[model samples]
Target: MVTYRAYIKKDYKAEIRWEPDHPFLAGLARISFMTVLLVIPWLLLGMKAPELTPTSSPVSKSVITSQQDRIIEPSAIDNGLVIDTAYLPENEIFETTGLEPPELEEIIDPINDQVTEAAWQSVVVSKGDNLARIFSRLNLSARDLDAIMALGEDTLVLKHLQPEQVIQFQIDDNQFKSLKYPASLVTTLHVVKTDDGFRAETLTEELEIRIKHVNVIIDDSLFLSGVEAGLSDNLIMQLVAIYGWDIDFALDIRSGDHFSMIYEERYKNGNKVSEGPVLAAEFVNQNIPYRAVRYTYEDGQSDYYSETGRSMRKAFLRTPVNFTRISSGFSLKRKHPILNKVRAHRGVDYAALSGTPVKATGDGIVTYLGRNGGLGKAVILKHGGQYSTVYAHLSNYKQGLRSGNRVKQGQIIGYVGMTGLASGPHLHYEFRVNGVHRNPLKVELPQATGIPEEEMKHFTTQIEPLLAELDNITAKSGLITVNSHSDLRSSVL
Candidate 1:
């Protein structure tokens, strides 16, 4: 009888050996074993390993280096050294060696491949996460962060981290080897450990900006139609800003008005990273077409211009705030909603959700920034010689706006609110010429500087193709949704 211990100690080949006195099952088992042994050797000898051919992309983790006959030892390496192979007899193209290559000495900088398996780790910023907190979680000392910050202003961006922003790091033997922070979609900050200490550099990625086209007709609202036409909310806001000086989108956009645009879509490595500025756009408001193309000059100054070389920007913004409705218009004999009495309405009341930004209509200085008799939280601005504007009924003023403070056009001076005597959150806007009230909607706005005579030819050459593309795609050409999870940093530093 074969015991468990005895069976384990016995040589298995003996049990399978063929013998005429053995049982028929034992003989069959021996034949099957021999066949399997022979078949396995044959199959293994005939099989081939998969060949690794080079691809168009960069190789990761390892470099394919062929073994050479010669050896390179660091101890024997001399900068001015040269070896002569002439001593070997009759060696034309190659030589044979018996010795194996020596193991390489450590390099000063850890190459991407030599950094150990999965050495690089991505650290995600959590709520209330900062650089100190992130470093602490990685078991990194405060000195490491201080050393990184000491690198200079280029590394200053790492001081602030937003939630969900990824910070990549590499560690070797509990020592910080390198760190990479994405400053923006097109810019990355790299910190590498060096012999001199830590080195910081900003690596900027080239932006491949491709122009995307869109054409949509307003069936109800510009926003609704724009979305259906594949326009991103970002692009829609850009479109509104471009034509905002001429058209009040809140009230003036009609059911049939069509919008066309050619804007920028920034890309990296064939993948889109961010949305760029609108290159050229056109908005036909009430059958009146207003076309604008962004033109950059030799000095790097850029602004939007019309086909006739007229500047797209007006002296004053048509609407001071993005409001839902025009609660009241200018009238000599009107019934005040709060007072319930017939009075002269000297200004246009713009009803908006509370906290909507109220912008300055033009470049001006604040003449008054206090509550008037009925205009609560009022701000009065004097524009150069003749024009002056009034904004009232605000929830709050811009942080530091004061009387005599200079304000540029489109600067937020206050917010929409119902402070003293208003039915809803609204902005009471009054445009005056030499202290006399004028209809803001009907008042003629001054034109900005157009293309210079010297640059007009260049402007036409650059702008013609953009205009043609808009005209050609008069059909329903759609835009795309923006990538919301994009890097927010604007530049490298």
Candidate 2:
């Protein structure tokens, strides 16, 4: 150590001392102090640390062991909660500390099972409302409308649609899926999705062909007379076909001719849809009554027959005319306008516009087709055996028409004209048997063959009920008239 001395004032001199090596000792002291400062806190904190306590009660192990041994009583209790030691013991302390029982899943019901039916929107078509316009107003797509219209051509005719017809649509999720209509009758359409595509099925009530009769007096043409008598158009067509062979509807119908018919009227949903076929019909011409009945044979052939089972169809039709007016009838010792002499008029003449088609009277072979004497252009058809028919006054023959050509009955052979020694445009029709001229209108013609015998029994069974219904309608109509021409006008012809 180094020391320093100093005198402070002459009277009292004082000595001062200084230590030069104290810095080195000070460094060692600082290090020693820092060491103690760091170790003392750690040592105190470690001695004061908290300890973990036991979670289970002391009796838990005993209770668990007793349960496992099956020696614990049910009355054991701890913390005011009774312990089911017999089932769960304390030694097996239920450690629900971090565990939870499985959640009970909630049940849900199916949508379809609980769904309520959707409401249907209905619209009644007022006068002048059409399906297209209405559907457009409802914002339906053109493709959807087209699909509905494509159902059927016959089913699409809106002329039959009437005012106030109820139309209903089932809209699910704003899309049209079903439609229904009910007027005097009801019709339903169901739309279903299939593997191919969407399709519509039409469901309608069964139609019952019913018989209802009402009598009408003949006052005019048969067509008008039938309508006045409440006969449906379908029935009228049937009547015409029935007597087509015997009656030349274009000419032979007289004002006084009366008719009575029995036929079926079809009804669906208690409303009349149409009238079916005529079962039987009676026509009185010139005081002679003609009757025809519909008969079907086992061979599936249907024909009109007389009461005596004679076929109503003749072997040859009365005339070869097609939509023409009869100008004159057969007359003997009559003066020909062109010849200006008392010559025999052996055939009837039909007046029609030039170029009007003429048909063959029956199936036959063309024997001749050329000009001859006064019979300008002519065609001669030779039927089987002794029957032959001649057509004169033709403007031109049908294409490929020549001698030796086979022609079926009703086939067009030529056109009408004043070709031969005639006055105006007309057809000269003649019928001959073994070359002997006979009145075409008055000849007793042979009937067509009836249905085969084998089919007769089945035919009778099938057609009998239909015929009965038709007869019942005819009788009820009371429109039947016989042999009275005065009230009927000549306009009917």
Candidate 3:
């Protein structure tokens, strides 16, 4: 209630009483008041300071370290005031003392435990390596090998380890947790340890069969031309077999001859594993074109046929045996090499190495299978009705073959030898129609069985596209003069 000017000049004090007889008491009272006055302002200042400052939540040792390491000094902006970082409180100073964080063991200990828990080892099969030897080398027990082999025939594929084949084993505590063997490009054998002994499973990888086409012109040899066209030797051999009956590859092939084919390539994991079968093929020999398309019947029997559905096989193969060259051809009157006189050389002589396999040209019964006068070791085959073939100058006959024994075409009947009138290792082959001799190379052989009438529609439908594809490639590339797709199909139909 005092006036404002009077209140500004007012002196506030607390009253105290002291005895006049004791001067020391008065001195003590004066000193006590001064001490209280000095300590009051400092105590108020300490309490007010906590309220003004921004309070932070308690942080762990790891969190403090992460925050300090992440912080960067503030940079001046266009010569303006730069904000500097404040010092940490005394309690948090120990957090930045260069000690390892407690959470690192919390994170890395689990990682180390995982690394030791699951581990794998791989071993490649070396030369002369068997399952027993391989397991022994790896310090695995014999019982483990026996258990793996006892899984049955499917597991037996793992028993035969070819050199360079790899076997991978998942190990835990020096024992096999699982085993994996890649048996082939598309197959893997897995043996896993289970509570109930060991279990084996075969994992068959899916394969992609891609159809590919190639066109090749004969300049030198078929083999060389095939290689140039990126075709494998197996594919080339298959191509030859498809057209072998219609074209005598050794004698009938001429300059400007060409071939085109569509075949299958098996792929696994985006890489080509091997070649499959020839799907369709065409060959032009001496201006005549031969076309073949492979077809599989409902019963799984497969064979090559013309677009018109005629079988590519014939009653006899053109050549009885694969030979180097034609040493002698069929002739009515010719001088014998050993006889030194003009005599009828009724057969062709195929020059080859001694012991080269001689195959039966046609399915027939053995009429004679013994040594002959001038032909040396000979075998005479009598076919149905009008056909008869004679093979001579043989190294030896196939065992268990005798007169009256039935033999199939392409069966090995004997071997090449320099027997009888031959001057070198060669095969003497003769073909007769009824009692009359004929040129084996020029004879018109009977066609094999064709597609049944009921299946012709499907076969024609399937082959048209292949034939069209082949002709398209040939025409575009100017590879050869081949029959038009329609013309070839009509001939077969």
Candidate 4:
């Protein structure tokens, strides 16, 4: 420590002085003063000599033996509480007599932690929501997001968030633990966090596919009869498609014609989810029975086939478009509605709603795509060297369909519209062979490839039971259609 002094004189003059100590001498003096002060406290307390050696008191051997043989009991303390100090080991008593023990740092294993159960939180995906946004909403870090996405490409499915899809999260202490994301109607992706890292797996459910049989009598129309017989519109369309190769649905369907269907229906968790393909069906038109069965080959290719294993698919679909009615038939000298003059009508006009899809009847390459004089927005397909098909009066052509692009059979090529000299929205379809116009409704189409000889035995075995069931249903002419829920089940079983 340094000291400053000031001296005042009577003549208004003042003198100031400052002194500093030498570092080595000041350090020795400070230590000596602290040592004397410490010893003075001890001397004033009358402390004589410090005990250097610890003292021990000897106990008799008989006393130690008696203490071990006695049964100690809890004794009442001053606070009226029972104390059980007698059960504590002697070493514990020695430890408690000294200073308090030091606190130990705990080691926590995440996987084996006592607080393992996580509270589940469910969030429905909303529009414009993504996985990162959801993670941020849950106060999760970007590092966690990266770790989860590291699961692989399949884990990226979390990025495709659909509105209203439920995504579940298991969170503990505001940390992400696991996730349950429904990948599809029958599959879910389960992502879990482990001690090492995040793990992901796809869990799928097996749906039960059962056969269903339905018999219906045509009273007014196929649609009405199918609806009355408890058949979905899709199933009815499939039924018409199976036999469309042999029958003309627009003109040949009779009121007395009847049909039977054996199709596949899928169920999940004891509840029907949706309908599958038509396994077998029979439609009698004009007293002619047309039977078709769906068969799958060993190579995993499948199609509808006849009872003799012949393919039901022809070279062309019967109707180019599903239409309301035949507005005009193929004619030779029909009066034009727009021109008001007798003109040679070479094609059939199918009346349909505007923007209805028009399909290519056969697999062929587009030969022409331009606006004709009367047939506007037209497409002409050349099948082989001799056969050609024309579709006219379209709203727009199918994207990517050009002069050289090849289209398959029943592929949408254009839409119906009232373009160029036309009356309303309708499809003007024409078929030509050897550069000669032919009636589309009457022309015979080629047959597609049938089942191979090696697969014929398997095909026969599968169709036998389906045919027997059809025959049994047909034998009961007056048997009512099973429309009730339980009756329908019985019919299939």
Candidate 5:
């Protein structure tokens, strides 16, 4: 049995040695045997392996002969045709053709529809016209106007329509859609049309009031001095506003009448648009001093005051002469231009053209308007609490002006003329406090109310920052010069 086993082992080893020496031939034989084995089951089950086509089947062309240099040509069967190529593998034939596959189309509903909306237009109000008239001119229905008017009386007044005030209208095919009124320094309203009819809306804008301090030092002309001191002409006019009741700027400002003011300036977006009231001011005329301080009360009313808490505003101002030159001044001994005599000059003389209107210096009842000895065409006003002002030498009186008629501060009473106590066409102004003659330019007038106690905290908070800004500006401009003296040290400390 051992010898027979050894002979069988030797025969098997000899059979292995007799196999083909070419690896290609050996691999071919093995492939043929595996193909036969794979085909038998397929054939027995009544199934046939698909023929490979270059444009179709990719699996059949993937299997290759053992020789790398040999290429397989595809079969000509229409079901699965394949082609041989020197450039690329048969599986990549479809990709090399550079043809994109057909894409599936997206489905959309054909019955859907869409509608577009329209836009609105805007308009601004012009001068001397109200909103109701504007709406009427636009051909809006009376019902709509009535509806708008019914919103509120305040709303109607808000719509009183100042120049450049903007208003918007919304319409759809000539039918009213809505209306929009933007808030400004005035009230604003908005209305919209809905299924239930028109609905109104109110939008309020919170006003941001910012204060700035502006100072002006008169050096040359008032206009030039204001420009040099960074004071806007508007602010300068405002500084002279309060004094309009007292002094006529066109006639009263002297050459050396320097003025200092702390006034309220308003700004929007860091740009100054308008100015507020003058807060505090000091005006010096011919070496005489006058000061005014503005104060706000608990009830939100404001007035000018003196340092001593009296009204800076008196029952009367010092003079009524307006837009005139001081051709002559008060003097104890002087040659009058017309009289040529040394006479007691009791009043200051202002020279102006004839028919130049003279104003009453304060609120008072007109006591006299006829004439006096040597004084032609005079008007006298008796002010409150034993004070009176007289305007003499007039061409005529203002219309409807007569004795016993009440006059407010700065009311026009008469005109300039060469009347009694003769000179050229000039105005002689006199001030009598408690029936005693006092120097109109030098007398200490009664004071106005001071800053109210309730508004003190608000004023301080608002004014501190403005004062700091003013200090910075003054320092930068070198307007305030500091002297190394004991007084300076005391002031600084």
Candidate 6:
């Protein structure tokens, strides 16, 4: 207890004092002295214990008497009997209480937690590893291997096992039950030991395709930007192919160019397996934005189109070979490089490596594919109508290509080479309409077919959402590598 004190002076101050023996409070806090006195009631009365609920599964008991009379005596507790609380004996309850008994799931094993897992042994195929060698390593019998080999043509795939392929099997009591070999991403070879012999079957895994978004702002080149955006080489090549018709990646790409697109990624067992085709894309090259969306008609043919239903592709490609530079352009009355004579330059010469693939600009028939006077070995594609293109200075033509064969657009028909009247490895390409020669670089290419007028509404309705998603993803997240994972549930079943 504390009390305040006041002293009268020029500077009055207050003081606090403690009162240990307070007069107003009496007979307080005598615990140590009253400890023995508290046990007087226990000495006069007695001790008792309460019953407890069983924490384990109850064991049922059989009784011939009433619930109150069925209580066992002390001698009934035998020490030799093993008590299993896991299961109850099939009998009535020893004591009939009015309250309802609890179920086995109410307090224990509520979810019926009983699961059996397979014991599978897996082996990875290394170099020079064959089926016989693997079976011998696993201590498998030769007769079983012979029976597996005799199962026919379906089992022939097992004869050739490539490195890194996995083989899994289940064994119990030194007996093989089943075996599996993953042949590819989509198929698995399964063999089981039947009562008669061995059975082989191929099982296919249904793949799940998910949409992935990537936005890239070019700092130096498209390849570097795509790498920064975490794109694979295959995906970058696909992107180039999608825009190869409108823009030449070799010469037209600028530093500030940016693009956004949503593409497909295949997944199995929740892990990404491979990449798929681009669905929709927007590329802004030198401040000019070009957008394309994939559209499929009822005939099962698919193509890329603009937002306004214009085809993104043209009748011919602008650049045929992946060249390093333009050595010569189409000009008239220009001094020749080798002869040093004023001559009419009719074609553009593209400098490249010797074996660089030369692509066909348009679908056409091969009219000429042999040596000319100074043009050397060449292939001329005669397109439908009055259009024709010539490829000169070839090293060697693509195999399986001959004169009078039909070639598709962007198909490799020959390779870049310096065969005749040339100084280095290059290609001299000329574009001709009717009989008049046109510059391949500046010639306005013809347009390809687009969506029909009747199908414009359908095309717009189907492709708009994909474009809108790509736009939304770009708007929410700026130019960076992002995997949106917006569940379109692409093809999962």
CA lDDT, every model vs. true structure? 0.68, 0.60, 0.70, 0.69, 0.56, 0.69
Better of 1 and 3 by TM-score: 3
lDDT of 1 by residue, 396-482 (tens): 899999999999988899999888788778899999998899988677776656789999989989888887886666534543213
Q: What is the per-residue lDDT of model 5 for residues 373-433, given as tens digits with 9 covering 90 to 100?
A: 7778899889887888888888888989978999987678888987886656878788788
Q: For candidate 2, lDDT tens digit of each residue in 1-493?
A: 1111221111000101111134643554465468667854543232112101111333332334333322122233233343333333333444421112222231121221121133445666788888787778767666777766776643364335576555655555665555545433445454432335445555566678875544444565565687667665456656777776566554566776766666678864333556766767666655455667777654666678754455666677776764345666677877777777778889878777888888887889999999977889999999999899999989999989989999987789999988978788889899999999888868866666665577566556765664465456546655443532221222142
TM-score of 5: 0.56
TM-score for each candidate, following the candidate numbering:
0.64, 0.54, 0.70, 0.64, 0.56, 0.66
Clashing pairs in 3: none
Candidate 3 structure quality by residue, lDDT tens digits, 89-142: 534444444344354455342212222234456677899898788778777777
- TM-score (C-alpha) between model 2 and the true structure: 0.54
lDDT of 1 at 224: 69
Best by lDDT: 3
TM-score of 1: 0.64
Instruction: Kindly indicate the candidate among 4 and 5 with the higher TM-score.
Output: 4
Error in Å for residue 176 of model 5: 1.5
| lDDT, candidate 6, 1-493, per-residue tens | 1111222111000101211132321122243226435743332121100001121222221111112121222132354222222133333232233223545454342111211123556777999999999888888888888988898877788988998666876565566666778878898887777666677888889999998888788888686688668886567767776776666665678998888889999976444668968898877776566777899888888888877777777788776786767777788977887778888889888888998899898899999999986788899999998999999999989998999999998889999998988888889899999968999878988767778999999998999798788778667656542333221111111
Candidate 6's TM-score: 0.66
The regions of model 3 sitting more than 4 angstroms off are 1-117, 217-221, 248-256, 418-424, 471-482, 485-493
For model 5, the superposed segments whose C-alpha errors exceed 4 Å read 1-118, 126-143, 150-155, 182-184, 194-202, 213-222, 228-230, 240-273, 278-293, 304-316, 332-343, 363-365, 384-387, 398-408, 417-424, 433-493
Model 6 off-target regions past 4 Å?
Answer: 1-118, 149-156, 171-175, 299-301, 353-356, 452-457, 474-493
